[model samples]
Target: MAAIVGSTPTFVPPHVVPPARAIKGLALIAGFLRNPLEIVPQDAYEQDYVAFNGLGPRFAWVTGPDLLKTVLLDESDKFSKSVQIEFFGPLLGQGILTSEGADWRWQRQVAAPMFRRQDLLSFVPVFVSATHRLLDRWRRSPAGTPQRIEADMTEVTFDIICATLLPSSDATVGLALEASADRLQRSAMWRQLYVTAHMPKWVPQPGARRIRAAVRALRASVGALLTERRRALSQPDDLIRRLMAAHDPVTGASMNDEQLIDNLLTFYLAGHETTSKALTWTLYLLACSPQWTVALTEEIAEVTGGKPVSSDHIDKLVLTQQVIKECMRLYPPVPTTSRQAIGDVRLGEHLIKAGTSIAIPIYAMHRHQKRWRHPNAFDPTRFSPMNEGDISRYQYMPFGAGPRICIGMAFAMIEITSILATILQQAKLALADVHAPLPVARITLHPKGGMPLRVWVP
Candidate 1:
């Protein structure tokens, strides 16, 4: 492992201090809409499993690493993506993320080669240029200016995904998609509420019409871009071109227009949001921990040796990557994942009945008392090459585990490292205000309010 970066990091960044008691009844539903992390009882941070019976369906909250493996891996086949689909199906369609069974299998098979390590590495230059553009904008601001970094991160990541996956997107379409992301997330939350209460999909909710309109407009934009991608047959380097040419080997079939639109929207929305949250949190941590920030800045200089941060420097920036890993551990992008049982089943000597919902509150798991020495501290050494292997795969899964793991893991990591390295090389960012932003679970783990930081060259 790379030598420890300065002393052991002890600065505990702002985090969600879960409620002492679990909220129940309408309060639970209200909490779900407000911030689902609040719904996680305090003891989930210390215990393996917690059960609830009063909800419409039985709820099983599992944080035990061994049981988590069973639910997410060993007996994964016994669970269905019902709850997840109910939440995302309206927006994402039956794409790789919301689909299951043979349908999901074939889609994953077709999408696998697109994220090859070599192909993802080739995107490093694009990622760097995107970051440079954002930095240039920040540079225009006078010194001692607090930049809206949360918004900036979102914009840069969106640019990277669009450039690599959908170059055919026009400025208008791109802008519309960006504006609708938060609205769609809100709409999805209501969808989750409807499912939990056994309400029908067509039932009315707040802002339902506007959200539906946005969904229509977003799909139309992707559909138009997909059409354009089809016309540009020579551009085989991009994801759309590659997907257009892919076929299901068993049946020798290509994706239909709807399927193409489904997957394209899946990648466009899901691809960038997670990475943006990661970058935002990592920057927040750096701003708070001066020693690690200096250590990382020094390491970046050592790795690049004054040259631009290229793909070669990514692996060499071991401490930088460790900091990102630790940041993710402290604030996972998607704080919870869930599955509904296909039938009654036994997990760790507990009987989970058919139709029961199993929730893996990842935020709680990452900070469970038994998981680490100081679960909430911002320590990167725990993720260093030597110690990382000691942690169970299920315990530290920011991108998730098993077959349904995020397909764009490599793409996200490369973009994050490239962008972070470039930003540090160009300027220093520090917290603009003393007010600490608490973690909130939205579509992504958003730091409530927003993350504003002062950017200036040292």
Candidate 2:
């Protein structure tokens, strides 16, 4: 897609990480532990592909769709999950996200039906009602007071996930996970550093005790929910219920308590966190770009006729969808991901040897200067249907691309559309602080120091 030909953008949303030259030794460790973005080079944004040999294996980072398709899809088995176990294994165990071969496939198959279009459409009310609950609080309180958008989004999305997936569970479940959320997120940075350096998870690191405590607390919560489900008089129709009934099509195996906790925690943490971060950035972009906000509000008005966001209006809110698409482009939920080659593979002209690590720094790729015109500007029009086809799927992957892409992509988009439509219908948000929050990688992309917005029903 071509750049919007006009005068310079007045507000090019915050992109604080200046492209870094290669950093090394203690500085590299410090930089990586602080934020994974530091390890990425400018070439990642300017070139289709780049490789560096270090950090336990020959490292290849690719931004082009062709090369990405080769690695993420065509040669997927040859390129297995890298370091995911070290980073999230403590929290998720041998869940779908970290498992390989038959284990990952069957687990994915079992959970797949829950995310189908029909099932996801049924979830729109939960999405709308949750947003309304948060908005109702703003309606009751003082007008100009700042609301922590990040925290608000997190809580609302967390509510949505639990309500939709674990419909039978209640306040106790929320209390269990809520207590551990902050500590767990903080621990991720250290985990990433440890995994990248090839250090075992048990290696003494910062926040190690709290991280263990957080993991234990989350697991206990899920375990209780599992027991609660088993003792129920009838099987309620929800994800938990589905998991109980599901058996592996191939192996005929079923999930035990430990496995249930593993998958539940995976969905809980991955599901809520990514969508929350996406909305947080979307609102921030809206606050900075009033024109886009006006555009979205108009679309929401025209489509819903000032009614609450319903499933019918989701597809009709095009501009609302575009703004979210662009926001994700600027600040992708999972900033980067990697895989290791199990066998020799050739991507483009480069021959990847066995054990080579392939990194896909999605944040850089989304804003890659060569791939996107006026790459850093906060313009949503590029995602418009007419222009969107001009872009390649791999070059602009916010939900990721190919087979292992997020299972909840449709769920996220529908939820995002519903929540954005509901909130924009009544609430007006403005940046409370002049300081722009830097987008940082912490399992999911989060605005550093949180996003505080002056939200009011005006």
Candidate 3:
């Protein structure tokens, strides 16, 4: 009965009404218990894009590009990022990702300069080096036999993040940091969903306990690293050092150790998880579509002249970019986004009351029948500049959109492209099994069972 664009407000059905069903308040909890990523039918997108009413009172399910624009752009001020992302507060502290209003703006300002084009360019060698290290590890495996590669791309991406953002000593702390990160990410997913399902945060739930433990471990590790960096006084230009030295423009105060740790943790967590999942999906897609793999191989060969792929050649790998984009379309790492209404607002015809949550199902929107021509098909051409012109901006938001869009967008693209280019150049991969793997959505959408692949020399 909602009024959105391209749809009639009045129902003119001349058929019998569907049977009534009981609403399951505990549906999300059950789903979490099962696999934490099982798609519930209640949460499934229905005709005209209506799904389950969110956990918040009077919340109406919002889907599709038009609704996404309304929430993310048109009525942006009425929506706050804090309400939807409160789950991150406990783990990341009051960092930029979880902050709102002026505080968030200031944090963004200080961090924005660090990810500029020049800084990103300087980090290219770090990416190149990490990729080469990974390839070397792969090469060490016995010859002729397919190497069973079950790498956690999260670990790989985290290694690169550490190398680029901090001093070399940070790499020594990487293994511990990575273990804590994985535990935190997994526990956060479960706890956030549980809390969203109306479970009291104070409850001594197993997931909540794990989340707390993970958060504590992460903070301790980051704190020790920050102390070491401050003491060593090395790598003045690195991100952690920069944050340690940043001054508040308005207040003329610098970030204290706690604030610095919080911001660093936020960046470290976000920087790697999404990009890692993206690379995992990209590799899986490459395995499924060998033609694309062959094409990517040839492109890498021509661009690198059979030499090692470097960040300088990243921009030239257009086909690799397309392949990554197509993979994102199918298995977006950040598959869902939400906002909380600050005042009564009318989205289409649906009256969303104050304090109501507005969920934009990026996963469903990307796969919507009317939105994408071949919604389920793996087509890299969809991202080609010539063909991309026809796609709506809101329809393909892997990193999100509008004023609060992801600040790490450029960094992520660079990492994915560079890592993927290097891998494809030196290796030939095949799916360990013929059956297509289902995505396991935790903090990010990951392939179930680690995307096992048989890797060999190209």
C-alpha RMSD between model 1 and the true structure: 1.9
lDDT score for residue 190 of model 1: 70
What's the TM-score of every candidate structure?
Answer: 0.96, 0.96, 0.89
Top lDDT prediction, candidate number? 1
The runs of at least 3 residues in candidate 2 whose Cα sits more than 4 Å from the true structure, single-residue gaps closed, are 1-10, 200-203
Q: What is the Å distance of residue 262 in model 1 from its true position?
A: 0.3
For model 3, how does the per-residue alpha-carbon lDDT over 180-259 read when each residue is reduced to its tens digit? Answer: 87787666655666555555667666677777787888888888888787678446677787787788787888898788
Candidate 3: residue 345 Cα off by (Å): 1.4
lDDT on C-alpha atoms for all candidate structures: 0.85, 0.83, 0.71
lDDT of 1 by residue, 31-101 (tens): 88888888888888888888876456688788898888888889999999898887778778898999998
Better candidate number, 1 or 2, judged by lDDT? 1
Write down the lDDT that model 3 would get.
0.71
Query: Which residue ranges in model 3 land beyond 4 Å of their true spot?
Result: 1-28, 35-51, 54-56, 144-152, 168-172
